[model samples]
Target: MRRHTIRPLAALAATGALALTGCAADDGTAGEGTSPGDGGRTLHAQRVMQLTQVHPQTGMTLLEGPTFDEEGRLLVVDVTAPAGEPKVIRVDLDEETAQPLHTDDRGAYTSAQFSPYDGRLYLTDFAGGAVVSLAPDGGDPHTFFSGDVDGAPMNPDDLAFDPEGNLYLSDSRGMREGEPLGRVVRIDRDGEEATVLADGLAATNGISFDAGYDGLWISELLENRISYLHLDAEGGVASRHTAVHVDGGIAQTDSIAVDADGNLYQALHGRPAMLVYSPHGEHLATVEIPAGHQGLESATNVAIVPGGTTAYLTVSGPAGGYLYSFEALAEGTRQSNGG
Candidate 1:
């Protein structure tokens, strides 16, 4: 985890507001800009909102993992610090007000999700190797999972839940030593123990179930690819295959979100944009921030809004990044069609 003192909220807000203003000016539009795509394609983004800075004071930061709550509010984790405390924040989309939901001194919170079934927030702690469950009203947080589950060392990174209430966690085992492999662990509602569902992956960072809950999609960050694992009758992986392969040395995928139409969006760490792929793994397009934009230094995580027309991306940086909003384009809609 990275370390930095929390600044005053007012200061952060001012900085973010200024950054958004600058971005809007550079694009020559109040709410839209053009983005580049592969094979000379182009995408257009109509900016719905721009959150420039995230901090306890500013109420947003380089957002790590983001998801929508039952009431449609956006929840995101802050992972700006390489060490020390981190925060989880909730942004009221209608009001545009960000409020700190939870804070932990153990380490940076990397990813987060809101369970519609139970209305609890599940967050992953990277350095601390734990999964925390917070109450919906911002009550005390409790540990859902910790290090060394079932005697196997765990470096828990990201997670997703199925309709049956089973939580699937991604453990990037042994990452710091440069030999990080991937494993998927399933924790039932009873909290009895952790069970490894899949193992020996090349750096898995994100996982999400298909809308039908019959298949799982995982992001292989180091390999710059996505894989689909077919689930068997017991809800375990029966077989797996590569779904997509990203080119151009932009392999550090951090988080992923799926829309109603089955389109997939991936947050590319170290790259300045998000990659969009069709369900068949074809590279559909790329979404980029305007060149002079200040908020998007490193696009890390993304969450599709409930209606599927908006995507919120977390930008990682020292000065704190923003929770940027981009309108989702319709299927088969070319960039020339206002994206």
Candidate 2:
């Protein structure tokens, strides 16, 4: 395992203030608790390691989600200032080197995911309010779905794909001061689009589907709750409900990931811990991370590898960020249950 350390910004600005208010030091132990898992099972998560920093080739201002491609290379979206010039960075785990995958000339890119079916990458442009599809080899980006769905630019945030190749995105509306309410959208493979989903939400940031692909769950950063959109037989979102809500003042719940057993893992943006939830939206435990490195002031994204035994977390600091891997102790339980 490699360790990198970076420094946090001097001022306790927006990011720093949020971190201080949300996280409290723990005994450095993996979260211990039991919650209802998928099909009467129980789920748990322990903190294996805390990565101090990640070294990017070029400095990234605000980094968000990280997903792996077929080759296991990590692709991350960097949404910094200069508005129209966000970048996509690829990190090689084997060599510990980072390279630019793609750069935007139109707007800032926030979250990104790789399409296994087409091998293309799909990303959300917060400023442009659209989703752009780019070639994996890095080339010109095509407008897969621009939220100009009724004339106005729909504020697109994070996104996830279903088994049928349709992309489900979150359109966080209330961000521009006085605008429409936030809603979830679905885009077809052929570029055909529909606002099949809508909800009265606040800052709908990260989203993910269940392991069985039967329901969709989204993180409401402003409201501090995880919202659920039940899936129908036709793969359409049929209904909506609240999955989980944090009781304390830690409201900045941003990105989320799911284990093989259908348990949800989310990053408490304002806190240094990762919150784990059961399929029924029950808070099971919190994976506490020590506060030694700089970027640790903010933990942005959480991801579980395919085997379900390991997890990757992104710790963002002032200079840059790094990725940390954690080993899941209950790996055999998830594997045996076909998670």
Candidate 3:
């Protein structure tokens, strides 16, 4: 597996148009953050300064979903422009290079994760309204799940599995205006059954679990809120509740990541910041993004390096994107259900 250290920067100063402030190396005391706790003082994140631009400035690939393969390589989807074709690219951190993987026909990929049960990459094929799997080397792309369960199209967007080896998916009708129809769906660990866990969601974009697996978190884009669902032992939603609601400012949250301390990092797609929340859903901090793809305010997803000390983010638009790594204020819990 590949290992990476944060490439050195002269200082943590904001470069160019990023304009980052109020965050720098502190005494590490700014965070009296507890270990795996459910409460704490409103903590500030150490400014997420860019590690390096893994791509060029005038780029042309809109990036989605960040997943790390078993080899510790970063994988992301390119919702390619013009025809909306989808592709996958593997980024070698040690070499600081990206190589497009050869797939027979990936179609439209929106998000992906490495499954712990099978150790393969599972992805959302948006155009086909299905989920597909691929070998870690990006070979043998095949359909994993597709079609309807309760009459409507699955229209899977983003996905996450649980500690029990069960799978979860978000069926966002579309990221459209006005009230939208969306829901969270689940697949049993045996992959033999499908169930809709919750409904009436709007633009459900991202889903995840807390450090302790106590709650399942989802970002409803059009609804501008992150909902937490209490899951039954088999990984079905027993109860659902709102974790955080964005009343104003960058309400279209596209994705999220949680650290080992239960700190949630949300990707605000319409702005240049990472929204932070406490375990109990209280707003805590904001990490400024220096810039976006060709001025497009879309921060896609975040993943941590194996050592847990750094976080890598995929942020970009059709004009191009960059993989940025930064020192995190807290350590992260690796996906127990995803290899």
> What TM-score would you give candidate 2 relative to the actual structure?
0.76
List runs of model 3 lying over 4 Å from the truth.
1-60, 81-86, 104-106, 174-179, 247-251, 291-294, 336-339
- The full ranking of all candidates by TM-score, starting with the best, is 1, 3, 2
lDDT by residue for model 2 (1-339), tens = 212322121111112221210112224433334433433222223333222223343233556667776677767766542423337777776666677777655656667877646868888877676788888866878988775765555667778877667777776655334433667778776678666476667767667887777888787766778888898897776888887876526437767777777777777665555666778776656665544543454566765555656666666655344555555433312111111
Q: Give residue 12's lDDT in candidate 1 (0 to 100).
A: 26
lDDT of each: 0.62, 0.60, 0.62
Clash pairs for candidate 2? 54-321, 54-322, 260-339, 295-317
Instruction: Report the C-alpha lDDT of model 1 over 203-277, residue by residue, as the tens digit.
Output: 677687765667777877667778888999877889988888877373376667666666677767666677777
Off by over 4 Å in 2: 1-60, 81-86, 175-180, 329-339
Candidate 2 RMSD computed on C-alpha atoms after optimal superposition onto the true structure: 7.9
User: Ten-residue segment with the worst summed lDDT in candidate 1?
Assistant: 330-339
Residue range 95-131, candidate 3, lDDT tens digits = 6667766343435566888776887788886656788
Clashing pairs in 3: 18-290, 59-319
